[model samples]
Target: MSQPGPGSNHAPPAARTSPESGPPFSEAGGIPVDAATPVTTFSPVVLEVPGRPVDLRMKVSAPATGDNLPVILFSHGHGPSNFVSSLHGYGPVVDFWAAHGFVVIQPTHLDAMMLGLREADDPDAPAYARSRVEDMRHVLDHLDQVEAAVPGLAGRLDRSRIAAVGHSMGGHTVGVLAGQSTADPADGSDLDLSDDRVKAAVLLAAPGHGEDLAPAVAEHYPALKATAFHGMTTPALVVVGDKDWNAHFSQRRDWHCDAYSRSPGPKSLLTLFGAEHGLGGISSYDAKETTDENPERVAALRALVWAYLRSALYPGDRAWADATAALAAMATPVGAVESK
Candidate 1:
């Protein structure tokens, strides 16, 4: 697919911040450290969203294995859980990425953080989705501050190569963060896209919460309805399974494939063979256990994720893609392999 170049949609990088000027992941909710530690200390922060203090958990990556590693700002799936989903809930995806050489930060958009006193008063009020996206920006800004605090951290993070990856509601959040505007999930209204810090995004099983996929009636998020993500122009990749109930996995796959086709930049889609809504099959901590059950399947899926991450983090590297493609195709019947 045609992935978007550095300067595709939105304003030029000059309009954004430059390395000499400031830090890239700063404002966003990430911390930067110089020492060699696997996990940075956790700091509780309160971000102001329309005069409201939103609680957030922030952390930075340990020392990188290579020089000038790319940064990935991850948004966890919106379940009752916090950023835990990105860390321990799902497979060791985040850990794998970190081990490979990428700074990963996950923001937990707890409803309590934004609901405030009105949470009980407005029983019918829709949960704030926009706030979640903005929170991501806050995390980035915080990372920028970390750079200011610690030297040699400024240029290490390449904001231009930054990417946003999310699952479920988090996927939708990344969509909005990357410029995919849709109607509000609660009311049929347009959503605001004020903060466009994310340059590229990867949507995994993104829910069409407010979509009217059913011809008769359309669901919408009043605060976010009537909004359409235009000129996203950033390179994106959308992955989905075949058994996910939310988007019927297959439907989601088709939707993402179409989205990639419409995107201004290069894009690709990978449908896990018989995968389900919950990556229960592949998202596991025990690589050995999963591999034991189906080594071929696990290997293929790992190659897929590793290849994509490699390309996304280090653009212009086609070797990873080539190797992964060969690995994936090596297995029999294209989409018949088990995820686990």
Candidate 2:
């Protein structure tokens, strides 16, 4: 059903200098660089979300040959780039995930600049904060239709094993899906938006509680003022860049670590050494908004995320552990990985 989106409810640490430590994949974590399978992507797989501002349109990317593929519900961030915040963006992340495994689904949220739907006085302006989550729920609810729209993509999906991955504002959406709740800024009502269908998640450069938000930011997105992590009990891997600081959001660089530091057990943290908000142009191949442009950093980040999702969806997989070791073995590690 329809609900609040981003700007709806709200929401790292580190260890690496560089990940040039070793080869791409060791015995433990990563996959072979050249081993990625071919992928097929279907766009504009439109679906109906009742009460939504517009019809839900998505881009589905999956392996050309695979069975029992796990699913990833990728949510884009509210970046400054016009198209990077929509389904067409995050090519670096989406292509990589779809190449290795997992069926990637990216939705064009109502606030996406690509949609050009926002207005000066629009109630959903500033980003549909709450409605973003609604979009994910709607996507999961209509997987049958989504599969049918994509040729040879049915039955290959493992509906029971689903994970959520989000960056920036999108990470806030994952937080809510993983059980984060907060008090409404307008009223004292509790906002519980977590979804049981999401078994694991990744929160990248996400914000902390609204109470500690920059005075200017909190004024507009008040629902995040007290977004608590005690309720984020889902298994997740939280990724944060050491140098990802934005004065418009918060003055504290460590504010991004709350998703890992404040949350319960079964959570891990990845700290990328010299990265910024874009995390090496994950939004686009050459995203203008990417302050730190390093292809190696992007490769490492994508590999680690893939490994995390692999082991998370499969109980006996060694992808996460192996990838962690491979990263740590780098002569110049990308960052550090730790779990509680």
Candidate 3:
């Protein structure tokens, strides 16, 4: 479904948030929630992967009390901060999703600065790209151990229902999980790692069809320079800041929408006006990386994400439909949800 064009529609979700309101994420637009569960966070859920550069360390967050909870495998972006790229970061996003009843899992990928495991410090290294995807897979393959590691989490997770989410470079990982394909710049072999286990995804500020990369991006990040989403058959909601433009990455900002536009339908796009790469501080709360910091915007993001995943995972749940309707009810929504 073509999303109700962000600024183009006049319906309730149509009130384009001016630059003042800020941008992005899933808090159900303007829906109301009476209460949220308390969250519990566990860190250093170590996984032993022989032959791997380092022991895979991860963080897991979930409601203090819940049963049959769905899981969200969240991938952190390669931010400049020392910790934002680690499992310790993304507090704003992890806490929100966990409190809203998701078992959130975050892995410290090889690209994280704290590990410094990669031979090259380059954030866009192809090796990091491949390792990140494997990290998530490792988590999935060892779900029994992961659940056992987190106190009070075992037997609560609804293993059948799983979704993947990522931001920026992490989004590239989610893209691959959703079946996005591209050539390994080094060997020219196809790199496709789509997982049948992931039912859905939400990619934030993800790179698009890589047709127009900046000069530096082409030379430095060849793996990203040729990303293609034609095989991304998984259903996903692609969230992007209307202003997430970085000349070092691409000549066009809409390149982030390729996950939605270039892929098939059963997808939606949440366009935040005046929002930048950080998508209103999603990487970390009150961090220096967020150029568009706004508590209200982040709140909206939390609600929308919960509702989207809630409905997607549950057969009878109306959270997404209701959330979108709630957004349509708002006269000045921060953004609009257009589905095609």
Question: Using lDDT as the measure, which candidate wins?
Answer: 2
What is the overall TM-score of model 1 with all chains considered together? 0.65
Give the per-residue lDDT of model 1 (tens digit) for 56-99.
Answer: 54445434445566677776553332223433444445654555
What does each candidate score in C-alpha RMSD? 13.5, 5.9, 7.2
Model 2 TM-score, all chains together: 0.89
Q: Once model 2 is optimally superposed onto the true structure by TM-score, how far is the C-alpha of residue 264 displaced, in angstroms?
A: 0.3
Candidate no. 3 TM-score? 0.88
Deviating ranges (above 4 Å) for candidate 3:
1-29, 118-127
Per-residue error for 243 in candidate 3, Å, reads 1.3
Which scores greater on lDDT, model 1 or model 3?
3
| CA lDDT scores, all candidates in order | 0.48, 0.80, 0.78
For model 3, residues 1-340, the per-residue Cα lDDT tens digits are 1111111111221233446644453443467543678999898899999867679999999999979999999988866667887898888878988988899999999878777654464443533777788889999999999999999998999988999999887888888998988666457578787898999899888777767766655555566655788789888989988877765566665778888888887899988777777777787867766767766777777778878888778878888888778777878877888988
lDDT per residue (tens digit) for residues 75-100 in model 2: 99876667878899999888988988
What ranking of all candidate models by TM-score puts the best one first? 2, 3, 1
**TM-scores for the candidates:** 0.65, 0.89, 0.88
Order the candidates by lDDT, highest first.
Answer: 2, 3, 1
Model 3, global lDDT: 0.78
